[model samples]
Target chain A: MISQFIFIIILGAAVYLFGKNVAKVRRNILLGKDTDRSDNPAERWKLMAKVALGQSKMVKRPTAAVLHLFVYVGFVIINLEVLEIMIDGIFGSHRVFAGPLGGLYGLLIGSFEVLAFLVLASCVIFLVRRNVVKLKRFTGTEMTAWPKSDANYILITEILLMAAFLTMNAADYKLQALHVGHYVTAGSFPVSALIAPLLPAGAGALEAIERGCWWFHIIGILAFLNYLPYSKHFHILLAFPNVYYSNLNAKGKFSNMASVTNEVKAMLDPSFVPETTEVSRFGVKDVTDLTWKNLMEAYTCTECGRCTSVCPANITGKLLSPRKIMMDTRDRLVELGNNIDKHGKDHTDDKSLLDNYITREELWACTTCNACVEACPVNINPLEIITEMRRYVVMEESQAPASLNNMFGNMENNGAPWKYSQADRFNWAEKG
Target chain B: MELNIPTMAQMVAEGKTPEILFWVGCAGSFDERAQKITRDICKILQHVGISYAVLGTEESCTGDPAKRAGNEFLFQMQAMANIELLNAYEVKKIVTGCPHCFNTIANEYPGLGGTYEVIHHTQLIQGLINDGKLKAEGGESFKGRRITFHDPCYLGRGNGVYEAPRAALEVLDTELVEMKRCKTNGLCCGAGGAQMFKEPEKGNKDINDERMVDVIEAKADVIASGCPFCMTMLSDGVKHLNKEQDIKVLDIAEITVRANGL
Candidate 1:
């Protein structure tokens, strides 16, 4: 009875704290400007199912895709066992469904046991891939320190959690054979059956290991739930909505600014009057200028450098890296979020996403190729942020590169990017 | 055969609305090298006996350069003026020699109250081939020569028109080699996003030169391009590497014209 009371309190506190952290992230994402993404209900759902749920994009890299499937499928299905564990925790019963479920319970637990074992193998392989093999995409300059360690920590945590789960099952299987009190012969343990012989024959020792592992497994999951918002592993939750809200239009379409449209029309025509609105900053200098979807993208980045690896600028040794842009945006957003949390919403910061995190050179190097957009397994659009920052650099400050200024002048005065008379536009049609 | 290219204004004055209004972009109209491709496109239309007219003086920049450089104000201004002119002509169908113009005017202009059936020149040529209006009869044989199609970023990745350019090449009697980075995975030619107007940022190598590595690896005897910007970049790359004699960077329209003996 006392143990059940403690279990409820721990579960309650964990859920409350996790909910609070996720809510804070939601608030931070909503701090940005609003743009409607809720229009295409049917398409968004289909895309979400394919890209996020089906892991369709991940299959582009076959090795990673297959490995990721094992872990993802295993983790989600194994958590079903947690439901049984929770009932046992709350009701102070041993395998409460054992009598009612009969044979099906054994099959369900058998599948989970096999899945748990696969999850363990996949995690170990991933750890080696990260630490030993050191894939080029994982070793970008921005992936230094915390980013690298965070990946390792998640993998290690998952491995430990799976280990505890399997150990708990193995001990329980051993105890069931001995016909110990309340140690129900319920689950078919294909994986744990092997480990059952390794466990001590003494029923008391086995009970202690089983009970200890059971407690450790649930606590580990609760802790992992909290750890998500702090790490790049947050992608597990955010990937679904992010893929749904991804730009569905042609890759060529950079959305037109309505404010710019109003201002430009008023300038072009003598009779035209601009719609009156508060003077808006031209482009994204900070997180606040970005669309909420862009902010959501920042938080959703998994820091996989498939984008950087394929980027034309980055490929040719340019400072620009799409993955770094996402990381910097998220870092800046978190910094701003913390500032608002401590010093209230009105508090200001000298540091911005530009200059402080992403540099002028880095911003200029991008070719705006959609390789990054296409390469992202999560369907994150880093090009949108890069262009928005480029807008801030050009429109807000009037600090465009001198050559681009000449090009802009040509477009404005001569109706072309180069200095050529419009009269000669038809010159190509004339007989030489 | 004499090329019959009428201005939309001239066509309108004659109470004639042609089939497709040709959007001869800034590069096609002005750039000396690109002008050749422009003429060949007009030649292809005339050969196919399709009723088409040029925007001529009525045409201006699509503002792709300004828009990409983050000057949306200039972009919309150019776009609005062009849209007003295009709408005045009641242009129903449109074609462009430049992918930049095709992308901006087709994709970006529609939101600003201008929409038309826009097709890239390669797509137009592909349609002509598919309809049996064009053929490779009595044309230069590319037999035993390797030709690679450098998928222009705007045309392929931007608009998803990968097969059309390749289809134009299919009528030719040659080996079509794909670069290591081709189609959606294709690398940029260091000329996108207003990069054509300015010097590249400090890097180990120029992006075009980097793209040339793919060209060299493909062992291409000729580089067929669909975009004018790509033609300039790929041609310059050949020249830079002193492979000018080795590789001929011809636009798809030029190759089509040469292939069909038009």
Candidate 2:
């Protein structure tokens, strides 16, 4: 009874802490400016189902997709068993659902053991890929220190958790064979049954191992849950909502700034007075200038360098890595969120995302090719952020490059990007 | 070799509206090399007897460059002016040589109260071929040569029109080779997002040079392109490698024109 009480307290505290972190993430995302992503509910649901739930986009790279699928499907399925653990801990019942579920419980546990084994093997392979083989996509300039270790750390934690789960099942199965008190002949552990012979024969020893493994497994999962908010593994949660709200329009369309449109309307049609909102500096200067969807995408980034690997600028050795753009956004958001927490919302950092984190050269080098958008397993649009920052640089500061300034001037004065007269537009036809 | 390209103004004056308004983008109108592609598209349209008219002098830049360069003021001004003129014409179907113009007018313009069935020149040619209007058999045989098509970022990945341009190329007798990074995985020609206007920011290799490697690796005599900006970038890449005499960078329309005996 005392152990059960202690378990309840630990579980409650973990759940509370996990909830707090998630709430903090929600607050940080809301700190971004609002843009309506609520339109097209039907399409959004379909996309979410396909991309996030179905893992449709993931299969473009078959090898990683298969490995990730094993881990993903396994982790999700095993959490059902976690749900049962929560119930057992709260109610102080041994395999509480066993009597009602009957043979179905056995079937479920057998399958879970198989999934746990797969999860363990997959994580070991993943650790090898990241540390030993070192895939080029994972070893980019942005995958420094914490980012690199964050991936490995989660994989290791998962391996440890799965090991404990299998070991616990094995010990419990042996105890059931010994006919120990409260150790019912329940769950059919096909994989763990192999290890039953390797365990201690004595009921007392088996019970000690079973209890130790159960506590370790549950605690490890709770700790992993809390750690997700601080790691790239947060994508496991954010990818669903991130993909649902991703841009559904044609990839070519960069949205026209409505404020700019209103200004243009007044100049073009004097009779039309457009409604205007109080403006901040044009485009994205900091994390707050970004749309909430953009902020969510920042958090949703898996730090998979699929985008950077395919980037024209990055491929040719330019500084712009799309993955880095996402990382920087998240890093800045975390910093700003912490600042607001400590010093209130009115705090000033005097440092912005624009010159401080992402450089002008990095911004200028992007081709806006949408390679990054397509490459993301989850639909994260790094191009939008790049264009928005470019907007602030051009409109707010008039800091466009000399050539782009020339191109803009020519377009305004001559109706072409060059100094050619509009009269010359028909010159191509005059040839015949 | 006379072509039957009329301005919307002239066609309207004669009480005969064209089936499609051909938006002769700034590149097609003024870029010296791109002008040849403009002529070839006109020849194909004439050969196929599709009633298409140019926007002519009234047409302005689509402000893709301006918008991409982050000058939203200039971009909106251009977009609004263009949308007004396009609306005035009551254009139902439109086609353009450049993907940038097609994307902007088709996708972006509708939000500003200007929407039409905007199709790229490659898609236009692909349609004509599929409809049995343009027979690309033996006018200028490319049977002995291998041709690789460079996917313009805006056209292929941007608008998801990868297959149309390839369809036009497939009709030709030439070997249609694909680069490793083709279709949705296609690399940029280093000129998108208004990058064409400015010097590239301190990269080890120019994007065009990297794209040219794909063309070279595909072992093609010709690199077929649709976007004028791509034509310029890829052609400059050929010049960079001094491979101009060996490899020709022809627009898909130009290729279609050659194949149809126009």
Candidate 3:
């Protein structure tokens, strides 16, 4: 009863912490600016199919893909076991895979146990890939975060998971040895048989150890769950939906410019554009300038830096790095969240929040190539955010490259990009 | 009644209910060779009993170049005016010899509610050939003429009109050698997206020059194009390399006209 009470308290605390963290993360994500204006339904559907179900981006690197897939599948399957564990801890009877369904449950648990092992093995390979193999492309990337600590966490989590699986196996083995009529133990006796030899000769000691390990496993899982919202592992939950809603259309297609008259009227009259301000513009300069979806994308990023690898500008030694853009946004959101948490809405009064995070040059360096969006495993659209900033710079602040300004002038005056007479339009053709 | 040279207004003035509206875009109207070939196409249409009205000077820029330059407002203004003009005449379909005009009219104009069935002259010529209305003379004097088609981005990737131009070239009895990058992946002639209007950003080699090298590598005697802009650029590149003496640049329409012994 005492153990059950302790487990309940821990579980409750974990659920509360996880829920709070998720809400905070969600609020931050919602606060970023939106810039994507794609209307291509076919592209959206293809993206949804490929990224969501096909796991196309993740599979581009095979080893990590396989490992991640096992972990993903195990995490999903283990949810059922979690519910069963909670029920068993509370009620004394494990009814999840009991009776007629016992065979199927035993098979599922056996398969999941094997998958968990594979997943753990894959995590080790991932560590090697990140550290020892140290692919040159990953050198300056933001995805290579605190490698040693992350590896340690991953290793501990895997061990804890395995311990949980083994504890359950040990209990089933003992029950079978004692001739106790447990549903799962009947079909799982062979697995139990192998583990039984490793157990101490004394049944009482083994039982106590089993009880302790089981609690440790459960506690470890709850702790991991609580840590999920604060760690890079947050993508384990966020990437699914982000992939589902990814943009798949042709690159560099900006959303249709809103009708200028509508915009003006909206700004002048509150009824037109309900969300308008005297100093407000249609681009993101800071966290507040971002839309909800943009923020969501920042939060959902797995920091794999696949986006940085494919960025043409980054490849050519340009200032633009898509991974850094996401990281900056995420870090800024956390900073803002911390501020808001401390000072409430008065956090907006804090001037330092806007000073040093993201720069205008960093925003302008993008070529608006959809490479970042295409390369991102979680389907974050960095180009959309970049273009949104461009729109703001161009429309609101009247800021643009001088060449663009010259082109604009030539376009207005000559109906072309040159100051030469319209007669020059056919000069080359006349020569031909 | 004397026929005033068929300006766009004059064509529109003849009657609202013409059989076809020949959209002699700015390039076709202004370029001497393009104007000559367009006149030849008009004669061919007349011979085939296809009555058409030409929208002459009233045909402004299709705003493709402007839009590509990131001047969205100018594009919208031009598009809105063009839509209004076309709507005024109740013009159902438009035919143009210019691929840029065709792409702009067919693809970009719809964004401004200016939807119309637009086709390239090559498509119409192919249709004429398929219907047995157009026939090419066999074994015409030109020999040792290995020609390659330069697939303009607006025609090839922009609208997927690859086969029609190739069909026109095939009918001309020229050996059609393809460059390395043809069809959808075809290199730009450095004239697209208003690069014709603005100086191209400094790169190691001009895009058209890079493309012409492929043409030179193919060892083709002539570079034929469906778009006038491509013809001009490729010709310039060929000339800059002093390959002008060995090579010739001709529009597919001009080649077809030549095949018909015009």
Query: Which clashing pairs does model 3 show?
Result: A29-A295, A32-A290, A32-A291, A33-A290, A33-A291, A34-A291, A266-A273, B8-B55, B8-B56
Candidate 2 lDDT tens digits, A44-63: 99999999999998898998
Q: Rank order by lDDT, top first?
A: 2, 1, 3
Give the number of the best model, judged by lDDT.
2
Model 3 TM-score, all chains together: 0.69
**lDDT score at residue A168, model 1, on the 0-100 scale:** 95
Top-DockQ structure, candidate number: 2
Range of the 10 consecutive residues with the lowest summed lDDT in candidate 3 chain B: B1-10
Q: How accurate is candidate 3 locally (lDDT)?
A: 0.66
The runs of at least 3 residues in candidate 1 whose Cα sits more than 4 Å from the true structure, single-residue gaps closed, are none
10 residues in a row with least lDDT, candidate 3 chain A: A423-432
lDDT of each: 0.90, 0.91, 0.66
lDDT of 3 by residue, A1-432 (tens): 786787778888888998998898877776654546456667666766677656776876787687788777777776777787888776666544556575786676677667656666676776677678986555664545563465457656865676567655666667556654442344343344566677775656766666677777778888888877766677778876676566443332344455543453454456765343343654456767777767778778766777777654555454567877877777778888888889895557443212365555555444343456656777788766666565566565667666666766665565444454555543422232
Model 3: residue B81 alpha-carbon error in angstroms: 4.2
lDDT of 3 by residue, B170-260 (tens): 7664567888767644666766545555444433456567777788889998888888778778878988889889998888777776777
lDDT of 1 by residue, A1-432 (tens): 999999999999999999999999999999999888888899999999999999998987898888899999997898788888888988888888778889999999999999998889999999999999998889878998999999999999999999999999999999999999989788899998998888899999999999999999999999999999999999999999999998889998898998998887877787988778665799899989999999999999988789999998998888999999999999999999999999999999798988999998888888877889988988899999999988999999988899999999988888999989877878887743
Output the lDDT of residue B252, model 3: 74
Candidate 1 C-alpha lDDT tens digits along B102-182: 999889999998999999999998998899988888777778889999888888889899999999898888899999999
